[model samples]
Target: MKQNLWINGESVETENYRPLLNPYTGGQIAEVAEAAKEDVIRAIDSAAEAARGMAEMDAHKRADILRKVADYIQEDREECARLIAEESSKPLKAARAEVDRTVMTYTFASEEARRIQGDTIPMDAAPGGEGRIAYTVKEPLGVIAAITPFNFPMNLVAHKVGPAIAAGNTVVLKPASQTPLSAYKIASYFHRAGLPAGALNVVTGSGKNVGDALIADDRVKKVTFTGSPAVGKYIRENAGLKRVTLELGSNSALIVDEGTDLSKVMPRIVTGAFSNQGQVCISIQRIYVYETIAEDFVSQFVEEAGRLKVGDPLDEETDVAAMISAEDVERAQSWISDAVGNGAELVLGGESEQQVLKPTVLLNAKPTDKISCEEIFAPVVHINTFMDFDEAITEVNESQFGLQAGVYTNDLQKAFRAASNLHVGGVMINDIPTFRVDHMPYGGVKQSGTGREGIKYAVEEMTELKLVSFKLD
Candidate 1:
């Protein structure tokens, strides 16, 4: 199979193509077009030229286009899920869920298009503004450059592109190199839905070649990216006053209070840690349990983690699949070994077979250990016990990244305290930090990156606010 770039509502074949391999089976899936810096510039030019047309489009027309894309996605749901699983190694079931989320994201963008209005200002509040009438209006930010990650390629792309289109902004999308096919598929859907010729353009290549070009181009007005903190920081530094929204790294932690029922929360904890091979930005990497129930919870977690079937992502029954690359597996193994060397006990499953690093667990790891402090994007989690509730909150806040944290507590006071003092973007009570819907304001403070995603908030981010005032005679 061949996957080409989508520019100006057309397929663009390049002389140089990179073969995309299935991480699970190590089989060739497709040869994806390798976008050069020149190609990326062309894509940007296309989007820049289309911005005026998109801005002139009626909001109802934009809403109808978004809805049609969602309808088409629903019609071909299984094929889209297969493409995501094949390209990114996400399990089929989880890939299907991602497709559902993408559909909902577009659906929400459609709804938000009609509701994108600003508020009227009370000009009379000021001493000299007695006879003035003022209001504000939302306007599109022209061209948006969307850089998505490989973990949830389809849904994450929808999160950026859907809202941008809803706000009547043209987009220049650079999907993750490993998962460009999904982006092209989505672009095709938009074209079929009657989007204007140059409204959406996709260029695929390395971040250095394609992403840097997109970020440097002044024609691209806003850049929204989802990836590591290092790259996010680089974009922020070089974005040159252009609006940027970054959803970066996270070592998300969860606390299990003393009174919580282990049986009820055990499955969620397991899923939160090992889902997508722990590639998810919000996947729980650390767990702090109350001292009284630490041992019981750890034992239950280990048993449950061991039961997860590690195999091909395409397999219907497979619970875990291959990591994106062998290097990722080796890096995770080294971290596990280093943690064990640093007095952390490797309780269960610390070995790697092929590309799949079996879900590993550590007990009593110090906060200073790499697995505990760093954003280890792998299927490994460290468990620690806390004597006091306040100590657990403090421990969870010790890291530089603060995307989201979860606390499972029966006591209302503890839950409220956790919600207030967690020092993260969001605090989940009685649920995992990995819990997120398509419409919630999602982003982090500190090193987790600035600005929020989720459709409505993203629409606001992709637009500019202009004030309008008139003097009454």
Candidate 2:
């Protein structure tokens, strides 16, 4: 299949296309058009022009279109789900879940669009003047450039596009090159639902070429990027004045406090670590366990990790699937080897077959280990022991990224303390760090990202708040 770029509700066929493969079976999936720099410029210009039309559209109309798109997605749900699984290497169950979430994203953004009410400023109460009445209004930030990741291809695209369109902002989405077809499919879905031409576009190519052109363009007023910290920093440095919402990588931590039931928590941690082969931003990369139960927890967790079913994502019974590339697997293995060389004990799987790196667990890991400090965005976890709650909190908070944290504790005092002192964006009390429901205001506090991504929050981010004041006649 020739997956060309989408622009102005139309397809742009490129002269060159490259094959994309299913990581699990190493089979040809689809060929994506590699847009040239000129194509990028044309796309940006069209989307920028489309931004005017979108800005003029009433919020209700945009919301209605989104609602219609949501319905259409459900009506053609089977095809959408298959496309996601086929192009992105997402598991069947996860792909189905992602396909269903398109409705949720659109519906949430649609409701948020309708409810985009600006607050009235109490002018008389303020020290200004009794005769003055003041209030605020929300307006779209012109054009939006949405750069999505490959991990959760369909849902992540929805997270960016749903809000961009719902808030009456035209968007040019640049899906990850490795998994661009899913976003292309979504773009087609919106176009068929009567989304005004030029209102939404999709450009598929290398980030350095297409992404840089999109962000650097003055007409593109906002950027929503989900990727690595390095890319986030580059966008922030270059894309000035334009609103930016970055949901970047995280070295998330999970604290298994003393007295928590290991038997109960074992399966949860295993699933959390191995879900999507640990490609998620909030996957539990670091685990700090209380010393007393550390040994028992480590033993049980490793054993459970080994027993997990690993194979093709298309398999209904598969627990873990291949990663996006063979290079990613090798990088993960290298990190684990380095950690082991640095004295971290590998208690479980530390091997890779193709892109499928078996879920790994490390015990008695040191703080200085690379696996604990950096984002090992693979199915390898590092577990260390902490003598006290304070020490555990201290160790977890030392990382540069404060995206998310988890505390497996029943104590009211400890849970609250962990919530306060964790120095992360969101805290899960009984679950691992990978818990995200898609509608919550989710983002990191530090290097992990800037701004939040829930529908309401994204709507707010996509608009400019203008206040008007006038004297009563």
Candidate 3:
């Protein structure tokens, strides 16, 4: 298939094109237009010009369009899932779930469009405003630049694009070069749903070229990104005075406290650590198990991790698939080797074949080890023993990333204590850190990210509050 940039409600192609490869098979699946700096400029100009029209549109009309797009996605759910799996090497089941979540994201955006309310303030209470009525109205921040990542291509794009449209802002989307097909498909859905011309633009190309052009442009009012912290910091530094929401990387942790049921928690831990080849921002990378039950937990976790079937992503029963590329596999394997060289024990699997790496588990990995300190972004996890609950919390907080952490405990007091003490954005009491619905306030703190990305919360970031005051006679 030939995929081109979607700009101003049209498929525009340049002479330059790039091949889209299937990560699992190492075969060319399609070709997409490589957007030039000029193309990005045109997209930004179009979005800026169309912003007023989108802002003036009735809320219900915007909601209707979003709802219709959601319907279109549902109608073509299988094809969407297939495309995602083919391009990203995500397992079929997980690809389908990502599509479902994308649908939910748009649906939630539809609902939030109508509920974007502001507050009315009684100015008579203020000493200087005795006869004045003051209130605020939320207005769209003109144009938005949405930069998405490869993992969860459909849903992550939806998290940014859906809310920007719902908030009446025109968008210039810069999808990951590895997975631009999904972004093109989503843009087509918007077109079929009758979005006005120039309201949504998709530009796919090199991040330094297309992404930087979008970020440095004056017409783009806000920039939302999901990627590594390095790129996020660059955007923040260069995007002077523009509204920015960054969803960056993380090395998430989970604490297995004493008295927790091993059987119930083992399955979830395995799934959380291995899903999507553990490419998720909140994927479980560190496990701090209590000394009393650490041995039992590690034994059960290894057994479960060993059972995961790894093969082609298209297979329905495949539990693990290829990484985004061969380089990813090499990076993950290198990290595992480094940890083992540094005295960490490889408890289960640490094998790789081409672009696929088996789920790996490590024990006695020090806090200074790369697998324990950095965002692994692979199907590997480190397990360490903590003598006390406070020590577990301290270990979880030692990382620079404060994205999300989980605790598997039945004790209410301990759960609350961890919730209060853990220096993370989110705390799951009895669930894994990977548990995220479409409508929750999701983002991270510190190096992980700067803003929340749930539908309503994203809308808040994509808009600005305008205060209006009237003097009473």
Ranking by TM-score: 3, 1, 2
Q: In model 1, which residue pairs have backbone atoms overlapping below 3 Å?
A: none
lDDT of 3 at 183: 91
Ranking by lDDT: 1, 3, 2
Candidate 2 lDDT for residue 106: 83
417 in model 3: Cα distance from truth in Å? 1.1
Q: Residues 288-336, candidate 3: write the lDDT tens digits.
A: 9999899899999999999999989999999899999888888888999
By TM-score, how accurate is candidate 1?
A: 0.99
For all candidates in order, the CA lDDT equals 0.93, 0.85, 0.93
All candidates' TM-scores? 0.99, 0.97, 0.99
Tens digits of lDDT, candidate 1, 220-316 = 8899999998999999999998999998989999999998999989999999999999999899999999999998998899999999999889999
Error of 3 at 127 (Å): 1.7
Task: Provide the lDDT at 170 for model 2.
Answer: 86
Model 3 misplaced stretches (Cα beyond 4 Å):
none
At residue 383, candidate 1 shows an lDDT of 92
User: Clash totals for all models, in order?
Assistant: 0, 0, 0
Q: What shift in Å separates residue 206 of candidate 3 from its native position after superposition?
A: 0.4
